[model samples]
Target chain A: MIDVVETTLTWRRLSPRMLVIHPFQEVVRAAPALLGLLVAGSSSGGQGHLWSVAGVALMVVLGMLRWFTTTYRITPEHVQVRRGLLTRKVVTVPRDRVRTVDVTSHVLHRVLGLARVEVGTGTSERRHEGRLKLDALTAAEAARLRVELLHRSPAAPATASTVSPTASPTVSPLAPPAGSTPAAETELARMRPEWVRFGPFTMSGLVTVGVVAGFVSRLVSEGNVDLGRVGPVQETWRWFSAMSLPLEIATVVLVLVVFVSVASTLGYVLAFGNFRLTRHAEGTLHVTRGLLTTRAITIEERRLRGVEVSEPLLLRAVRGARLSAVTTGLRAAQGSQRGGSLLLPPAPRAAAVSVARLVLPSVAGASSAWEASPVTADLTAHGPAALRRRFTRAYGVHALVLAALLALWWWAGLPSWTWLTAAALLPLTALLAADRYRSLGHALTSGYLVTRWGSLARRRVALECDGVIGWNIERSFFQRRARLATLTATTAAGKQGYQVRDVDLTEALRLAAAGTPGLLDPFLVEAQHVS
Target chain B: MDTPTLRSPQHRVSRTAVWYWAARAALGWLVLLAAQVAWLVADSDGSALPVTAHVAGLVVTAVVAVAHVTVMPQWRYRVHRWEATSAAVFTQSGWFKQEWRIAPVSRIQTVDSERGPLEQIFRLANVTVTTASAAGPIKVSGLDRDTAQRLVAELTATAQATAGDAT
Candidate 1:
């Protein structure tokens, strides 16, 4: 017979510290009534203290109710949590299915010695939506729970002599024997890293953001301007006259440069504040960092889906790359509605490869294969054919549209220069169309499908053929006439649809058949017979 | 390989499908005509309506409605039964253009039921079956409350049984 503990545990057992959201979040919640009181008091010119006092009292009461209403429970078999004051929610998750547990502490939570733990179970159901705010567990407690939850096996002995002295009987019913090798401890020891940091935040980046924010806010609040109004126009004209034309152009360029620099710098800082990544001896990747809010994420090697390495054009010069792992379940920290993309950005290509190998043993040699024959052939031939087709297609409609518009303007007695402007648009459109065409390419082998595309920013996505869950080939009436087909490949990470438009029918079929071995023939027949 | 074990047969949908088809047909034609008129108005010059564009839009809309009327319900009523020894689920919707899905008893990640105002009036509930993969979340609607409850219970039982076998 099993005895259930009916008493609810306090949030302290989950984590001893308070939440680390923006200080202004609490203030914002309390502000409306306080502001209303102040406005009313100021209008009346005196005697507002009572109203202010009442407002503060109401805020305090609401805050306490909010805190007390949210509670979480952990059991030997499962974890149960209940929250929300009005529309009550009860979430129950079995320990066996829980895949990943992430703990995060914002600056406030860090100060209060509290943290929020998020648990993600790899299930598509609504009830299996990742749990947020499993709050206030100590680092050690959170780690222990995470390890036990992730590694729990029904086949393990029901009773063993090797149970840890510190293990809670309620949480761990059938502990492993003392002398037996502990898999969890070994994994923990292997994956933890030492330190992580962002690129230096230059001073100029901050000023640019402030300026841009100010400019945008001003534009939004002011609405449309009246050029007829002499006062505002005169002020603008005065400022315009103060700067030289060259200086004005230079300033605009400088502002744009500063804007991008600042944004990227800030992104780096926010993402990697005091970051410490460690590989636990047990083969788990343990990442802990944050200046204001500390976060720890553990990625088990077995659960890793794939490794993605990306290199932007700018980064290619320095051989800088970003690495991210695709894994089962959500890995977002607590109090964060959005999840990180498992990225390690701006590292050397070698470092990226090393990280990929460490996390995904299967993908170890996959990066080297990136430079192999098929990839090179696919990349070089992909763009030129696409560009040729784009030029041909655009010439039929886009050039005609421009010519007609120019003719209309010329007949309307507009300046001949306007016709020149219209004619110029044709060449520009053709150039853009060609560039777009040149960026598309695809290659497929038995094990993988590699797609490379992009004009300004290049992207190469490599997907394992066996991992492809769904595929489709679509052809419109126009595409049928043109002998082209579009193929879409869907994996666990949303849908990636690629078009091999304007390819010979035979080639298209062959390519489709190669990427999705059993699916293409039926899909092609269905598509061809659709009309 | 040995023959796969098959689960029990799924309950069929009640025969209120004709009304559903009529409702869909009316909405589809109305929306199609409205969209055609909107496009014509937006693209028209300030002068008289472009005769070619106007006629083309009307013809396209009519053709689309004709296609929808033929395709909609045939696909909706076509039902299929999918069952494996450890998992069982039923998929029914349309004949030609259909939604064919299967969830094994062991693969069921979550079970949920919802009832709208119309469903409440008709005492019908829709049950959604979720799986480990995010792509497919099967929704079987127009089931009576008793039927929906029984289906849920059956699925839960099979899921538990399969889980037990695996362990």
Candidate 2:
């Protein structure tokens, strides 16, 4: 350990233990090229392996060079990371602006008792997307850093700050948003292995399969491999082609479902095996999850604006749901499923609702006492206009598809069953439309604006009224004709905008006004008018 | 009109907005028109349609482009309106797909104005009122320069006066 005498403000290098893992990581990163070289080496006879060796050496040198060039320092008011060899790069984040602190360690790092720290300032700006990263710090050091970075208040005006040579001192005079609370951390949720039963309902498996299929197809083509020549492939094709139409269709569907379920189960375990959600007394929510590559994320609860309860159609059938935090700083586009915002992985719907309640405890008197629960309160229906629009759009889409299929049957001499199949889908579509109509509702309750919409991915977003920054009222030509509008309450948190889609024009306006009173007053024709 | 009953915003933007919009629309259409001309030249010999057919094709495209360039701006000008009070900023924009956006002055994060070459020639500017939302930044375009400048200055001051991060 070359670092002698630790100063709070001095530039710090990554743990030297990272030197053991970087070369391996570099090789993994460059696997495709190395694999190609190996294949080409055998196919075209020689020297490709030599090129591969040289490439590995170059990658290792690059990896080791990174260790030498990179150094991070915590100034009185900011956290700065300096890296790059020739074109020097420095990323500085005001300490108070720091939103999240993530400490992750892969299998190798875990073995070496080292972790990587990622400080998330949570800005979606293109120039500096993720704040800063310090790779391969000792596990204890990373844990200590995460706490020190998030829980501790930024420098007060009294401290005379020293600027690191690599950094230009741009110290902010602003006070930290939350003073550190010295309360004990409370565990909100822990992953139960039984929750893996919800794995099959998630679409993650299909995504993995699609990616693998694409890669395989590309590899087959690139290598000019004749899959048809493979004995097993030939036998499978023959058997498949010989099957009766209905039997073949059934077989394929059965195989797909089986494969998808298995993949999703694997993914679920890999991602959420040891997931735990805890609230720190110092105003941070900690989520430690992922099996092989463990991650511990620290989020300031003061930045939390709300929580979302999401139920995909399939998951809803099984009473399974997911939960996410609606908070400032994090980019909405990154998605809650894979990041710091994920409050709970797919679990029992009851579990998600409970977690939501825990995350957003309702105000005593302010919360609508009549409702059973604050987060899952009975919402105000969007009325007949929205219902009519739902049915119209639903049948309109079905009519378009049926018409197209019928045209093919009449003009192009296609099978009658093709049109019949399209017609047969009507009942399902009708069911969906009805379900969607049922879900189309919004309510202002419990100091939160809850907008529930969508059938496929039903979301009941409970955003704090205080978090809403603006209002957007959009009426399409059809919506105008129907006298309905989509009111989007835009905020800095979560998805940024949660829409109460296809509500009556007057109703949308009323809801917006109620959510953030007085803003819409001057623009309304009559503040109290509902019709 | 048998439309929904909220009152329209106070201002209809500078009448010069029509000309500015026409120029903006034309700039886009001209490139498409140029591409059509290029493609026609490239394929003319191979397709060898009757001269009348080629002439008709070109004429139809030109007619459509010109009609769009002319009618869109007029429609937009009629629809685009804006109002800014000390309390809130309201804007209505777009022609067929109209959007009505309102951001409280307290929630507003930034007030910026931009002028492009086309806007400069028309003596028009666009005033943008940004909030902390990703779907925010309500813009009132084609304002006369004087109004745009005053609006930016006034909104900036109003936003600063309000407490909290506004989100």
Candidate 3:
């Protein structure tokens, strides 16, 4: 382990065409600022052209420098990349440590027949730190490198004895020629045109609009762009001012619904347009998706620990669900279904369940029904105590708010209708509490320890028993008073720890001991029954 | 279900752990009290309105700090326990909100011992063990320095003897 070799290794440069691609990308990145500058200059009669020209020139130069300074090489034993011209940084990862290889191509790259290859090492604490990137390569070379990195063959001998100056793609007989004999692929799920109906339930349109609006508003605020002076803005304001009070509210709501639906529909089509989940003969799951930026990610089935069935409140209402694989070393991109973990998009709950069963053989069961599938199997209820606690917590907040609202109405000059409105909404809160109680469940079936919890964004994780490394039994002050505890099964898969919240203390201990037999036995003191 | 319960781990951290907790709590309270005193002194404009209020605030803080420094240490000392066997490392810690963590010997990736300035002043140490998960590491806090060292060595040796990848 203390051995260090001082031999020089070969390095290769990125495709020269990427230099052109980089400048365009940089220009797009700076478009917001450029728009702001243009607006400011237009308001002040002129002055932004010089700055814009200089900025573009600087960006072009910076983009070209990447092709000059960045170089990477894949040896038989290690994959190395050296980046930067002024302050040199060289990152080398052992060949076997390569977990996932992603080949992504945007519209420009696809047009240029160039692709970007990112090696996911998943070893370092920071996600990006563990990644080694090759800015642009021929689509063929990118595919070859993907095979070369993950195929784990040592047939290439040039890396061992010869210090080659460039990546000799012809010499790498180690990787069975990529795209030669297409491996058998088992297609699990394909995008359906009708699945677009579940788009508005995801609320991604609202999030996208919020993000874009916030960014544009920030830029507009910094500039002199009078949004009210814009033709559409002026017309909209005039139209709004021309309406009666109730009509205006109804119109605003109707317009918002239409806008959100259209935006989310567009987003959904763009994201999952050509979504395909396929299993390869080499024991890897291939996920290829996206519209403008085509992404292809490979996940090793052996690294997969389990699967998670996710259902947000609105999606659940529409009987739509999402399926994500719980795997080690795969990036979990939060709040987006654009990662290696997503197995199915927002589709029919039955489709999501069937896809989950197909993806993970551990969930093989008889029924194809959404509820009967092991992914959504019946769970043990936490009994009336847990139910009571949920109600108390729900009504507890409502009671406090009602007291405050009534106090405000009595002491201050507030209207009484506020408290009355809150009282009228009491039934909604009870429904929510009941839904939360219904969602809280845990079970052990086959080799999977299943735990499901949460209200708004309910997720049911089915983790393999062998993947559990440790257990955390915690009793908060209130939980202790309720004679309940939260048992967290710690694993290296998605989320790291999945908790069976608010369970009877003894039952929790039993669950822990049963999940991974010998792990918790030493800590448990058996209460012998006199049967 | 037999309704089994957890038995507290076999070893209390150390007798000096009480002093360590007390000293740490007292240090935090001292900083709080010092900041409040400085604020009171700086904000006063020879006015009686806020002087009395600040003084009352000082009294309340002092009362809470005294109770925390006195009762919390003893409670923590009683709560903190640890044990290590060939199979696993177990610990029970915290006062009002207690936690029991158990990590199998084979799954432990690394074992480390640390002594902060406060721990050093109290002649105490902490031994931390971790696996590949981002969940909280198992820790044995306020141990005697030599005991922490031995614990680290024992855990490291046990981990070396096992063959799992720790993931």
Candidate 4:
């Protein structure tokens, strides 16, 4: 047996782009500081030239320090980096747990024909853990390094089964050397289409959001009013012609609203240009797009934990549904507020369902067979005794708070109609409760745990049981009283915790038991009872 | 699940961490005190503050400083742990909040050792772990040279093991 020892290796030389762009980019970034210094020096007067020369000299020194300080190296054993001028830093990362080699190119770097390569190791606990960025590398060099590291590292065994087309024509990338082809076929049967592309972009909704934001900012800053705002002006003119000055104000308000909406929609379209999605050979979903600054996001297929498709009340009329997926990593720009998934805004429900089917097959079939298990069947079978009792016990205070609101409205000497309006909330509350009940379902099979829930907007989540690196059960003071518990399952996907809330005490325990076998001691009912 | 059998080197945070935390805490307190004093002076009605209010503010400041000095290091220390196995290196740390993390030998995407000024004086370095998390990556600080080297060795061994297993 060969005794192979790990050693640090020097990184290849910095890409030529680094030399070209580093100086200008640094100067631009430090423009404000330089401006502040110039203003201060000029105000001081007597030795302005001296200070200016000194400042220029300082900036040059700092820039050179930054450039010379940065260096990186990768070996079959570990990755090493040395950086910092005043206080040098050398970091080494092992090869085995490295998850991915991410190559990113900003506008400047792209122009310079260079990319920043971030090596990500598979331990996703802390924000900066297992992450190192090498400043610049040529595209070809980066790809070659990535390929070599991937081959050397063992995190992904299946990659070995995939023979590179360039490496051998006889060997199929998907087919292993021997009997693995049959297993690969079965795996393929189970592997649904993992991503959907819209035009040239995978995340068109995000672009739309950016456009909307830009439009709003422009309206606020530049005072550009659209047709809707002009409508009020026209209305006011008509009113003036008709000798109705008092009503002119109403026309102005109406015009402003119309103008804003039209302008915002136009801006949105302009922002989201040529969106598309492409599946990489490595089972990662790559979303690429941008009119000005193009972006490509690679999301691992297994990291996808859940998919949520939503249709708000206004959207239902338009036959539009938004699709979002929740994965392990940090929240993307579009999904930060709602949690998980990308929102494919305003697609037809059929299209949404088709995409859903591709991503999550088990839950995709549930809508059509919604009746096989009546919405109320689980409610009756499990009954309030097991589930509803726990639900009311957990959220019954909300009902009382609504009742108190109605009582206060009545006491305030407002019109009696106010109380009626407040009382109308009871049905809404019940409807929400029923929706929650209907959406809740769990199935464990095929090395995965599939959980489904949601009301108007439905969600189906599938997680590999083995991939679950940590599990925690939490209960508040009130939760203890209600015998309800929340179970959080954490994987390598960053800190956006996935949870099942207000589950029946017994059911939660059972699910946790099924999901985390040896991780938690078996037959630990005492621990379960505390919650 | 069967626990994989492996051997690892015992590792601890470099002594530099204590001084680092202490200095950081002191600086933070100074900044906080300065900010609070500025706020109080700005918001005060034209008249000078009463003795009671002055005393109360002093007491709060004292309490905050004490808490900062005493709590910061413990919190820092508890949030990180590292071990080097025969095959790979593993580090896991998060306070009462637990994030069970493991970096196998073969799949380590990158390994890097970093040192700031204080760490240089103490001959210490920090190691970072990166995965595909959008929030970015995770890092562990305060490792000595010997421990870092051993970790690199273990990681290489484990990576080789994985490669062997796959083949």
Summarize candidate 2's per-residue lDDT along A1-531 as a digit string, tens digits.
112123446988999988889899877765655555554446753564566568888989988999999998876677888899998988888777787777888899999999988776644332344457788799987886787677654443233233233222343222232224324668899999899999989868998899778765644544445578879999999999999999999999999999999999898889888999998766789999999989887878888888888889989999999988888766543733256678899999889988888878555557434354656788999888888899999999999999998998999899999989888889999899999999988888867888898999998888888888888899888898888899999888777788989988877877888888888878777434332
In terms of lDDT, the poorest run of 10 residues in model 3 chain A is A1-10
Better of 2 and 3 by TM-score: 3
Cα lDDT of model 1 by residue, B89-151, tens digit = 545344442333443455566678887766675567778876554655567876778877877
| Deviating ranges (above 4 Å) for candidate 2 | A1-6, A29-41, A45-64, A122-130, A153-183, A221-224, A333-337, A367-372, A399-420, A527-531, B1-5, B45-63
The TM-score that candidate 3 achieves is: 0.88
Q: Lowest lDDT 10-mer window, candidate 1 chain B?
A: B1-10
Model 2 docking tier (incorrect/acceptable/medium/high): medium
Best by DockQ: 3
Lowest summed-lDDT stretch of 10 residues in model 2 chain A? A171-180
Kindly list the per-residue Cα lDDT of model 4 for residues B1-106, writing each as its tens digit: 2322111124557766767767767778888888767767775773576656765886799797988787767866755566654433445444434332333343
Model 2 TM-score relative to the real fold: 0.87
lDDT of 3 by residue, B1-167 (tens): 55788888999999999999998999999999999899898889846447888999899999999999999989899889999999899999999889999989898888989999999998899999988777858999999999999999999999999995677
Best by TM-score: 3
lDDT of 4 by residue, A238-310 (tens): 6567845556666656655555545544433443334444444445444444344333334455455545555
Q: Assess the local accuracy of residue A145 in candidate 3 as a C-alpha lDDT between 0 and 100.
A: 80
DockQ of 1: 0.09
lDDT assessment of candidate 2: 0.80
Per-residue accuracy of model 1 over A1-531 as CA lDDT, tens digit each = 132123323332333233323323455554543444444444443444455456656655555555566777666666777777898887777765565567777665656655667776554223434464566666555555555555444333234224333434455443232214444442211111321222322233555577657654443333322334549768977786799988887977886776767575665566566554455444456556555666777665445544455555556445655555555554222135343434464556566655654454443334445454222334424433445567777787776766777777767665676667767777777676666566566666425565655544555555555444443334444554554545455344312223344444445556546665544332233333322
Ranking by lDDT: 3, 2, 1, 4
